[model samples]
Target: MTVQFERRTDRPDAEGRCTIHLRAYFEGQRLRLVTREKCLASEWQTDKQRFRRSKQGYQDANDYLDSLAARVQAAYRQLRTSGIEHTPEELKAALAPPAPAEKPKPEPARMLVVLFDEYRTAQSARGMRFNTLKTLNTSRNLVAEFAAKLPKGLTLAAYDMAIHDRLLGFLRHEKKLAQNSIWKVVKHIKAMLAYLNRDRGMPLAVEPKQLKAEWVDVDKVYLTAAELATLEAAKLPVGLVRTRDAFLFCCYTGLRYSDLAELREGNLHDWSGARVLRLTQAKTRTSVSIYLTGTASALLDKYLGEGLRLLQVMANQVMNRNLKEISKRAGLRELVEVGDYRNGQDGQATGAQV
Candidate 1:
């Protein structure tokens, strides 16, 4: 049940890599592995693949490596108890850390809080979306929570893969998060690690990857032509009819919900003194031109509200609810099913799904 450590240089196919940092070889075999910080976000310690970098990541990496060392040793002991070949190298490599980088280079001293700000600014410059940035912000909070419990002067680098995996695993398993949701948190951590590597030149022991989870189907109303007609015929609630018209406008113009909600007056023009609706979608930021349908023309001509926009985008949710109700009242529910069952995956941008 004995587990002995080796310098990676002592192992075959792993000589002078310096990246292996730590190892557990069995009776002269590459039994298993443990890792120390070789670079920022690089953890060579555990079976899990990724480790994000932090300013004071070494402290964390060491603690992680130590825990893994214990686990590998125990597993070898268990094999002996079970009468298996307790080869250190074989078992150890199986439990070895994920990766390695160059040793931690020299760096300027700075607070974790300060480095976090730097990371944020750097990622933002990388053209990250707001939602993505928000997730990173959340991951940052989780790190803070863990950091808070540590003694003063403790740096985040003082942690390792075991602790990082524990927290991330909780987010994935306990939170029961979807791929997209988990991706957000992990991406943020990875971004910070990247910053530490490039800016501070810290070597990491792990490279974080996307969660490699699956996306799910969205239950949604895609909209349809017949449903549009039913909507037109059905008697409607007062302002909701306008909202319905706006959503219909979305269907035809392909404006994102945001653009439809925020469209201003100046974006439109007159064709021979007649109104023409034109605006750019906020989501994709693409400009759109729509020759108003007769009904749409009427809504605009009749209720060209003081603002340049046709409908206030603020009330979109209420509008969708009312529109759905209008559809049900007009008996368009069947149409939604018909459109989907008919076209299957071929239904993108079709008026049938809405």
Candidate 2:
């Protein structure tokens, strides 16, 4: 077997660049394979079968030709050692640059619900709050339900404007979810998708930012100072006293349920002769310092002698259920209109007693 470099001056490209080819001769057959090297017709030396010295990078070009020739020779010797009958075509094939590996058909972008679960698992591992994880689980369930209703099923690649519209329709019409509830679900979905895209390197059909939910400010529900005093004084149930105390503490300190659940005696401290509650918020992971009001301090002192946790707060769901009963027993019934808005339009207002 013999191999040599040959510049194709007969067919220069429009840019006057001649393709350098590897000419291989095996037995009596000849084969030519294109080399990646290119140069002008004047830059090639026919007799030496390499680039002229005047050519830019000529030494590198000649070295490449030598390496390619050596590779072809090594392939020929290997074929001879194997004692297999081979053609010039086989020799050329061995010398030919390998076809670019088909880019691994990019691991069929994970199914939407499956990817959501993965995101939830990652968040759980990252020590996300229990309530937040629960919310994510709910979002995953909602997505699975919506996917079940679809004809072709859901996928990250299939998430587009039409799917977005269908999801909103399913939540609003079929599931009969309220505007704020729908917003929360959509927000969770966007968050998961964004996390997958940004952290997991998953491709998204549409930008997460483009998937928008029209959020409306729901009217805040709370008790007035007089009503709060009435409930604080009128509560009588043995089981509900802890729940009421926890709720009253939240009202006094404006702490979220998550922070209230995690509150401990260590969080209470003396600062400049004033007692203060210091804690890092679970959801936002932001540190906060709050000067405890008299009522708040009293509630903390009332719970300090109890079990391990500060207030021994029940699960949020249980506490909420008990709070309703506590409110009814406390005679804190004042009808108030609960207003909700959707898509910049006023939604129906429901009346509830506080």
What local lDDT score does residue 187 receive in model 2, on the 0 to 100 scale? 93
Q: For residues 1-354, what per-residue lDDT tens digits would candidate 1 score against the true structure?
A: 334433343443432233334445656565544454344223233343224344346567556756766887787777778887666544655455668887898765454545676787777898876544654676676566655655663244543566566656666776555555555566666667677877778665555443233434445554467656666677777756666666666665545555565667677688876667777544344566777656666655655775766665444335545655666766775433211121124221212233
Point out where model 1 deviates above 4 Å: 1-206, 216-221, 232-243, 280-288, 299-303, 306-309, 315-354
lDDT of 2: 0.79
- Model 1 poorest ten-residue lDDT run: 335-344
How many clashes show up in model 2? Answer: 0
lDDT of 2 by residue, 30-137 (tens): 767788899987888889898988788999988988988889889888778888656776676676679988765656656789988899999999988886898779
Candidate 1 to truth, TM: 0.41
Best by TM-score: 2
Q: What local lDDT does model 1 show for residue 80? A: 70
